[model samples]
Target: MKGRTIILDHLNGREAAALMLDGQLEDLLIACDAPAPGTIYRAVADRPVKGQGGMFLKTPDGNAFLRQIKGMAPGDELLVQVTGYADEGKAIPVTHRVLFKSRYVIVTPNAPGINVSRSIRDEDRREEILAVVHDTIDTVPHGIILRSSCAAADDKDIADDLISMLALADQVLNDDGKGPETLVEGDEPHLLAWRDWVEPAEVVTDEGSFETHGVLDAIDALSSPRVELSGGAFAYVEPTRALVAVDVNTGNDTSMSAGTKANFAVAKALPRALRLRGLGGQIVLDLAPMPKKDRRGFESALKAALRADSIETTFVGWTPLGHAELQRKRARLPLTELLN
Candidate 1:
């Protein structure tokens, strides 16, 4: 594993932590900010946006977008899940489709199915767990996805989590008279990311962060725009108004294979750096120039590095300048914003 270390660095005056992985700061989840993703809210369709497809929803926490107009109308109460955070007066993206996330499983209300995590690679174990989940899911039209945590969980744990999630969903569904009300608050960002994406072997936190949920250890990494990879390779990250650019350069004193090795090193470290920095939207990686024929190998390495990211990412292929172009979904403000 290229980026395996995990550290929770507490920040000053915030109920949040900077999740550092392999010396890069990845995400910032603040307790006082907008609702976390997976948070369920009871909202009413406040008004329809003119010429736009979706209507604005008034929730207890903030305004959300219900991006369909056909079956929804003003003053109609509905249950929605937060997909991303928003700035003041900006509507957070939301979905009527809800997923109740827990450490072990995600229960979808009124939908009946069982999907296991792709990370669960054991076929026999998957089948066995699927059997367990299937037997546990009864009567409710709820669907379930047994997360990676299920691999370590017993039958009782799975069953209990499932029942609790289902019960919560039912409660949200049956509740009435809502303007903007949070039905459920979500877990901290670090914890959520750890459960959903990277399963770190260890979690280290400073005394302050460990005690008060602050992020102090990741300050330097989160603020710096450079990442030094193994061997003599490094990346200089610059965020511009249009996009973020990463220039990969080789260090002093190298071998004939240094270029290829450096490119491979960048392929591994670049994505981890971008992810940890939470620098999304358009991203361009300027390489140290390699043979066109070897481009595929480098590209594959980059894609493999980002395989575990919870955010959706798309590789737009290489650029004419021997650079790689990619895009990641942007929801909340960049992680860099918090550091500043």
Candidate 2:
């Protein structure tokens, strides 16, 4: 019930990971049936869309669409990485910028250089990691990015991680094969939890961990649109085909500052709600009636909340009719989509 707990489990026979903090479900990642993000493929350019400046690719799985196809021909063969899931009937979204990701390092084949994460500000630690990188990945043609997790890791372990990533990068980039094929499948849920969730937490691998830790009950609450916030405030997050709509309510608070209080609570809770649901794209917020003077505070609160989120979100400013707008990246499939 304190700190964090990373639970490696399965949901409906598919791999799934859950992060719990203070006995509450904080985040989750579930592997879908389609190609996972970060999967590498040797793709052959098929045909280009007329006005979209995009090209369809042929991979072993299926057709993928890559935008920004400069200097690309229809018959050329190149490597691509799956960026995210596709719309219901669209081609899988792929990108030419394929990155080799690992627990401690990320190998960039396009750019060759050694860089450390900005979060590691200690000059001594940075220099120590750099020395390890030089010793392990010397004379490499590809780029190396030392992730922040290496800051507290042992030098030998960091070196080993770098070596592993470098080897994978070399194997994929230097492939001389002619036909289309999947070079590397993306990390499954258990592996993804081990790689990305960097906080110190209890690793719970026992089967039925989800139900035992109340994760299943929390997920059931997520199915409804209503999200109960602190201090008798609540918000409804409903998704439609076009965009997501959120409405905040003061709920039994009759004070003059009730609206402001409710809006602030929504600001702090919105990111986690969207993240757990895997909802993205257009989001419009309708707040309870509040003073126009409180707009700046609301924006600042929401901005601080979104900063902690891993998803890419653009705060597109407030609407003339007193609604907040945001554009979030469609990274993971909606939790509802996977659950249903």
Candidate 3:
């Protein structure tokens, strides 16, 4: 209960996973009926939008929109992977580039190279991992990327994962089928949690572990928009159809720097808030009324926080009405939508 723990269980008849750190829920993943991101499909090009430089494809799971056209013509067949979830009535967002990812290795069919994660700054570790890669992989038809989890991983285990992913990539790429079909399905919630949450943590798989470990309570709290931040400050993360709106409120201490301090707290907690709620896309922050000079500090704190996050988010600078704007990747479906 004190250290990190990974809990796998069912929520609302759907498989769910939760990551807890120091007795606090840090991340959550829940399965849904929609087409999960990373699903590979051999689709037939339906038609290209005249001026949008994008094309829609016919897949088993309804229409999928893939941006970036490269002389693509109708009736042509190509392999595409679902990139992220789409809004209601919108085409599933997909990309031409497909990546085969596993716990330790990611195979890139388009890019060819054996690369190590930049986080492994130790030269010796890099050399050792590279040695493993070179030894495990003889012929490189696809690029191999060693994830950060490989830093302290066993040599034999890393090699095994690399081999397995390489074989999978080859099998998917070499499919000679002519009709549109699904090549591979996306990883489920529990499997995805295992792949990404590789940090040392206690594993909880017993029945009713979610209730025993307070995971259900934590998820219930997420139903509310109010997120209590440090120093008694709070923030509301409400997602509308168009965008996510965040409003920060100062803590109980009404000091001269109360607004600035509350704003800093919001900045630090914002990423985790959005992450647990699975909220993304356009985000606008109406931070507490701090002095204009303090805006730079808030931005710096938010940028640093987001940099530490794994999700792809871009801080698009402040707005004219003294608000902050951000563009985040739609990597997962909204938690509320899935739960409901």
Candidate 4:
């Protein structure tokens, strides 16, 4: 596997660590701005729990000391220290070397009956928003998802996400407050990353006409050509009670030899099957077995068939039962799963 660096700036250390653990970032080497190896820093937890979260510092006895302190709130800034790592053969130990100690600007609402004067100044709006935030924290337990708009956000965007979250909380309160439904659906970053990484050449759909879906739209936006729809050539065959079989037939043409034609057709259609339906798991390609002289040609054709799909495939020669054995990459869901 190849390695790459993903720089997540302006994020405190814990946020960066969480992202690394989630496999969103690979080969993470955390570094701090300070020159020293054990310099301490701190940042507010995006999702903080009372009496639960803190950085671990090493004691004089060579044991870890879990430093427990409180002050940080969501979106509050903190400094973080990058500690050294201990190696135990293949296993590497991470040691925390610093602490984050700072008081956050408390944004909480005043008493309900208190009459507060309104102001038109920008600073006034900031204070007002902070007040709403404080009220929201007290009334509803919710976390914030800092948006990219936050970089140059001029109060409006931040207010919008906050307001949206509040409205969702109110809706939950009104409808007997069913157990934890999604209040807001954030963009799925993985799909976007996958799209950016794997530039698919063509997208084919079984449905004759193309409809706009976010995934399909993203593919189209990358200028991938649309594979025109053709009549279904894929079929399911129940050859035995233990296993189900999928057969690709040359349905339209019957003039050529069954063995040669079948081999050619299977070779041609395998990639389409892999991509269109995203087939994976152990796939047994049952090509029509040809004479001894045709074996080499068939193998060559099968190899050529798989080249366009962008998936690593292994040709496992032939099974004892005479079916051609092939293995494609694993996918989350396949056409067979959908059909069943």
Ranking by lDDT: 3, 2, 1, 4
Q: What is the Cα-based lDDT of residue 207 in candidate 4?
A: 34
Which residue runs does candidate 3 get wrong by more than 4 Å? none
Clashing pairs in 2: none
Cα TM-score per model: 0.81, 0.96, 0.98, 0.33
lDDT, candidate 4, at 51: 67
Best of the two (1, 4) by lDDT:
1
**Selected candidate, larger lDDT, 3 vs 4:** 3
lDDT of 3 by residue, 1-340 (tens): 6899999999989999999999999999999998888899999999999899999999999999988988899999999999888988999999999999999999999998989999889999999999998887677788889999999899999999988998888899999998789999999999999899999999999988999999999999999999998888899999999999999998687889988999999989999999999999999999988899988888899999999987899999888999999999998888889888
Backbone N/Cα/C clashes per model: 13, 0, 0, 7
Q: Model 2 Cα displacement at 217 (Å)?
A: 1.0
Q: Tell me the tens digit of each residue's lDDT in model 1 across 98-192.
A: 88888787887657777888878999889988778668765646777788888767878888888887888778777875477888887775666
Score each candidate by Cα lDDT.
0.72, 0.92, 0.92, 0.38
RMSD of each: 4.0, 1.4, 1.0, 21.8
Per-residue lDDT tens digits for candidate 2, residues 45-119, read 999998999999999989999999999988899999998878778899999999999889999988878899998
Candidate 4 per-residue lDDT over residues 231-321, each given as its tens digit: 3233343222223255545445455465566666567656654544434445676655467678788889888877654466777787776
